[model samples]
Target: TSTGKESVNATLPVGLAMVRAIRAYFEETGYLIGFKPAGGISTAKASLDWLVLMKEELGRPWLEPELFRFGASSLLTDIERQLEHHLTGHYSANHRHAMA
Candidate 1:
């Protein structure tokens, strides 16, 4: 977890680097580790950045939901807004995409 207060943009690199080190140390064991960066990520750009970083540092498999997840609901709302803007050419109100 990312302390739920720090940006994933700032923490993801450090986290991925640590994962790489662990993978390097356990290369012979074939250990598969999942990364769940929870909290402090609230922008569509941040979500996309996470995808890119995960793909670059952890390979394509890590992009799977089973391996990677966003921990912030607000982040999802922003993503939905971006998608709506792309598809409809207008951003919807944030309340339209409510999270439970």
Candidate 2:
């Protein structure tokens, strides 16, 4: 389902449906499925939103690194930049964080 656009709009519904089907069909709750959204998810806010979505939809267990991961270097860079801003009240230059 990699659309190369990295849109929550494109992916969220599909994820939700899969979870719904799993819950509906499985009698046991021990099965775990990892969710990783990649590509153009390049913003701190979007990453946070994805976290919230996973938390709300899939619960805290999915928040673990092994279960949930982001696959975008730009997203990592933006997250670092946001963290720096939050800590120092100053944003690093865009060039400071290089995207892979």
Please report, in order, the local distance difference test score of every candidate based on alpha carbons: 0.76, 0.72
Model 2 RMSD in angstroms: 3.0
**Candidate 2 lDDT score at position 34:** 74
| Model 1 TM-score, 2 decimals | 0.80
Clashing pairs in 2: none
The alpha-carbon RMSD values of the candidates against the true structure, listed in the order shown, are 2.6, 3.0
TM-score of 2: 0.74
lDDT of 2 by residue, 1-100 (tens): 2555644533566667765554454447667767676675778887777788878877788799987887766787788888999999999988887663
lDDT of 1 by residue, 2-98 (tens): 6576534346767678667656755767777777777767898888887888788778888898877888777878888889999999999977998
Leading candidate by TM-score: 1
